[model samples]
Target: MVFFGKKSPITGKQNARKTTGLKAASTRSIINKYHQLNKRKLQLQGLKKRMKKAEEQAKEAEIDAEITQIDSEMEKLGGLEVYQKASLKGQDQTRGGDSSHVLLKWLKNEGNELALEEGQEKKLLEVGCLSVSNAVSKSTEFDTIDRIDLRSNDPLIKQQDFLKRPLPKSDQEKYHVISLSLVLNFVPVTADRGKMLQLTTKFLHPQGLLFFVLPKACVENSRYLDGELFDSIMASLGYEKLEETTTDKLIYQLWRCRQEKAKYQKFTKNEVRSGSTRNNFCITL
Candidate 1:
């Protein structure tokens, strides 16, 4: 679910891009447009959900039309798969090819205080999974890795939305680790994002690990969210940050469930901070 820059939509050339300022500018442009389109798509999806709930025909047709338009645009821009490939390419060109390295590191770190009983097999859920060959998938740490994405054609990655997945009924059905890499920001509705977070508790084993990843800007530069605020939200949900790392483009955090559904603060879209060019990323409960 990693989202970042991509190949030039028109030229599709990278030799020149590899050695000049033009590459950075091109990457920024593609990434910006990618985020813009993704935001609009999620908004339309939220509207569609409301339309389904209300069972009203008044705005349904128009909403469907707009969604079609956006889908067409996304198809031309290569969908999320292309963005993921581009992200992998950058990783190959510079750092490691996936965020799983960090997640695995967090799990192995001694600072993670969640002590597991010996011989306890680990189960992992990789939401918004794009590939079956990812590091976590191949790792021996987990007894099993259930990979899923909202849109996927690969047989290995189930094409199912996490929100729609059946809720776990018992500890046996819950996962030991859940990877939410770059998936939260894709959730357009602020409340829905919070709902998604809360829902994780039902699917996770007590004291399980959750690896959360987001674009650096979501916390660093968003008008509605900041580092402290995001921390409070997770803490209120009973998730304690075990480790956190911020790169130039991404925010990675490994959290342990301390308590589930604890008393928490409620937040809204009120202006918490002001900036002329800030992103409107926020989560609510």
Candidate 2:
């Protein structure tokens, strides 16, 4: 945690360093501030170290200097309370009786090899996976995922080339499962939704499964294609809806897609004929 004096707002020139006076704080004061900030930073970093090491050390010494440094840093970076409140509000929004966690738990526990395929040890694919955030692994027994693919760039997944890469063919001749969580709702790219599904399905064997989480939310003015319209799309592509559960809101649902009676078949249509319809957002905040 390094601290610097304010820079020139217009010229964007960095202030020159000085040994003393207004050009810089006193040596004694600067040293004291850095020492205090460094100590707190080290302490916070240590907390993330092995729990054993943290337990061995006594609590950080209560120091007015350290508190003052922290306050200064907070002020320079924007008040801590602002981010705290925003984060808290986001948590509240996700906690409002969503079945995502419950469904994830069920899939993790009961899904097993059936979800993957016969003779397969364990392999999973996440389609339209976003930044590894809100992943189902947290709400279920699954921890590590084999692979994840996202259409958008995120801090954790900045490489866009990964999306265009072709999936390696699997050796198994049985079913394989690919999980799509809250991703199919944003498939607005023209003529790519079905192609993307087919592209992924080609990686699986005969009885592979495609698990999807569809949002019923308003996309009246949306530029992307979503799952609500995918019902006909999936059916046309030989993918059958196994289970679907709608929450109190029509804009969200948990659904599963598997191949029809005869497996390994691809969709015949390349063009979507339905005119785009605009839906109203009914959810009252």
Candidate 3:
């Protein structure tokens, strides 16, 4: 509900922050622009590395200048954390859907079928949590709902990176479920995506559930990922896919931790799917 009063690029004035919400196109444009700038920054950095090795001092300097400019623009957009908050706004009920809301409804309908111990309370760890009152937070299904994000806008959500979260001292400290909706794709490093998946297993109890979600384009339209490859990746990490739901915009999946110790397999960034305009999304394990 807070606005930083960031100026509108189109109007050259403070964008009227409305509680109602932005036009769908306007919201989408902001998100797309952020992605374009981020991708360009990475591309330029790669080119600069090559230029430095070739002794092209002048070209490298030019790249640095571009990088500095990009950094300024990144600040103007309020960086990834702020951009994510903006995206969350777009997912508000007024705008059509909140992913957590759907997750809550799905869980409620399938509550009886979940692998939970009779009369025992379950705990959940929600990574990339942005709000204190998200649907899952209000649900009674979980006795404890621990929320964390890279940065905190509210006191309720711990301001810590999930990757750096301390190891649990006992089984009680581990969670029965872990949620990572719309989280993995935001990780800037491709390899870290795999690492994050690996670390989630350590934070969950035996037979724990993992709720993972991503933009459909990540697996459906990317150059290096597909349904089969994604399944294999999860299987290699000792997770058995329990549920999968696909929509025009996103893919939601539930995976159960399994002790398939002998089934572990190494994965790499290979071109499993390809097309000229497909996105370059891949996980290296």
Candidate 4:
């Protein structure tokens, strides 16, 4: 009787395939969790709005608690972009975030206001510029634009740790405009954020402009910073606030570097502003 040896069910190739499948599933699960949390957060926001409109104080309090819980969970998971790598494959390529649109509009409306000769090249430095194709497209008026990011792989983006290294001599205080969109929030410490601001000034000309974008939470959630306090801090750093806009989600400000010492001498713990009124200060250049 001829008997065929029993074939093993698990070969090396099969095991490798199984591992790959498991990894892909894990990635999908993470992405799904992120989206679910995001969707729930939006829903809670709507509920909060309706509760406020109806003047249901009790219901509004409950919804506020739920929203706070969600925010805590999101913070644990490393913010809304935790699964960005996995979701990028399926996300709409055309949709730029709200901040990008704001930056584009600012560029279009204010690009010419910079004191440069009509034909002179304006040097611009953009930090944390992940996939700045939209910003670049809107910046055709600029003579030269340099973009840098720590994580981006785009050939046009210089991959460098902005906090660790000094800029080349040729680039020091050479840029006429520097744009930093949602970059400060990544620095976890408040002092480090201030340090980052200081470093940014090193790359800007004496009267150059810094277009800054940050999450509105920075002002609302911090006991140390309010609208007026933030303005004072900027002034102390030699930045004169040219314009500012505060929305529900983000804060946009345009400041010109004066290369002067901080005019505000003290920062007291008791100096917190009382109310939570959103400030939208703007000036015509």
Candidate 5:
């Protein structure tokens, strides 16, 4: 004899729940790609150390090929979330308030010294401006401000990589002010940071001001720079420090370009040995 069983009333609801679970799992897998890429990078670093210890050229060559493959894969995956986390953490710790507030305060206190023409339209360029909420954009002191970033999709922000592309020749030395807030520390290499600074110098007028904000740890722990070393490097780049303020978390400085001809020079042991004529200068390293 054949028997017939009743259909479960919750069959449709069970199917819907399965569909939702699959979608959530897919989304999580995409996010986990970044974490996986980071792990692979660390593994590559270990391989490099092993390659150094290897006495055979063939073994070292094999490791090098492996590293190249991993790096290419990582590049295809795009920017990692770990870098974004570090940048956001540094931004949160910045003490003098938001970028807009600090800029406004500086203008209120030091605008007269700038000798800017009354009612003239001032130009400002803000690099690594992840959003349009910059001080120059918010304040009435400037008529034109360009905010550039790589990750933002907002139409107001220029979606371009500052390091990879060159600014228009016509824009060179056209800005009256340039602001760099928590941008330098993201550069993985010291040479790259110097390159960024050189690019910044091109965008400012001869007497224009640079408003720089950086994490305090950059000066304290970075292999490339400290407070005094940074100041010397700026001097070599023709920037004269006009004002500086510091907090436990961040350092803010206003520097005026002394000459248009000054170029970026990397700090070196020989340069230190030459002795800095600038007063109150000392290199801890």
Candidate 6:
């Protein structure tokens, strides 16, 4: 069954914002506000220069609108009064938080080395990691990963060969955990999706958890149809449906029960006979 959780609220009260005497606070807030205004003004100037150099008139207009919005927001907060005062008093101002980083941080905390026992040669693979390399690099758990990046352009692992490479065919019984996020949907382009699933079973030790973030059609409109197809592929390839929550009709987070390779051999053979989509991104990109 799919379930959805409400969005978490921001917690600003716990932040280290400055609290000073009424007179001092007023002065600091005004100073801080002005400093921010000045910084934004400089950024706008820089953006205008870039826009002129690129002759991107439409982009320049969009940027102008954004700067105007920022100005309006600043005015609503207190014009330059709040920032100017804060700067003069060296007081810190509070801003609202981003939930993605917060959620990642909490997940890292839960899965850190201190939270899990140390082991030799911890295997970790992240496909379609994109710009989150820093986050993965800093993870207490991924720290232990013998980092195997599948989609890397670096001349290390043969591109897309990881899917075809022989995995621990009968060893779907020993790893502690497996994680896939915003990645599975990309498989139809670079590798055989069914082969990837079989490889997953081969790599995962028995009892290992399969954690994945399902594609959101709203966010990944191009990949939405493929994402649904992949979910069906997962079930056929031996993943037992476990907990899955719908963030919305278009987005879902899921956990699947693990399965072994020998059990799905017949299904895999049938998949091989029917040929599949491959190397679409390589051609498009």
In terms of TM-score, the best-performing candidate is 3
Give candidate 6's TM-score: 0.40
TM per candidate: 0.79, 0.45, 0.82, 0.59, 0.63, 0.40
lDDT of 1 by residue, 1-285 (tens): 212122233223322123222343455554555567778767666656756445554667666766666565556556666555444454443543488888988877897744456776678889878677777777888888888888774898888888889998767788888899888987777998988888887787888888999989888889999998888888888998889998888999998886745667787776778979998899888
Return the candidate ranking by TM-score, descending. 3, 1, 5, 4, 2, 6
lDDT of 6 by residue, 155-184 (tens): 432334446545553432234445555344
Candidate 4 residues 1-285, lDDT tens each? 111121321111111111122344544455445544555566666655655455565666666666676565555544534444433322223322435455556655654267564555788888876565654447565678888776664787788767765764863337888888767765533455676777777888667888898767667665456677778777777888777787765788888888776453544444354455533221101
Worst 10 residues of 6 by lDDT: 1-10
When summed lDDT is taken over every stretch of 10 residues in candidate 2, the lowest stretch is 2-11
**Alpha carbon deviation, residue 225, candidate 2 (Å):** 8.7
**Clashes by residue pair, model 5:** 100-135
Best by lDDT: 3
User: Relative to the unseen true structure, what is the C-alpha lDDT of residue 220 in candidate 2, on a scale of 0 to 100?
Assistant: 31
Clashes of each: 0, 9, 0, 1, 1, 30
Clashing pairs in 2: 176-208, 187-225, 188-224, 188-225, 215-251, 216-251, 216-252, 217-251, 220-279
Each candidate's lDDT (Cα)?
0.73, 0.42, 0.75, 0.60, 0.58, 0.42
- Write down the lDDT that model 4 would get: 0.60
Residue 227 displacement (Å), model 5:
1.6
Count of backbone collisions in candidate 6: 30
Expressed as tens digits, the lDDT of each residue in 1-285 for candidate 5 is 111121321111111111122333333343244434444455455555655443743465554565565454444433443233333333332323465557667766754245355555688887777556544566688778888776654688787777876665773336788888777654544456677777677777667888888767556555445677888778878888887888776788888887754655656532322223322112221
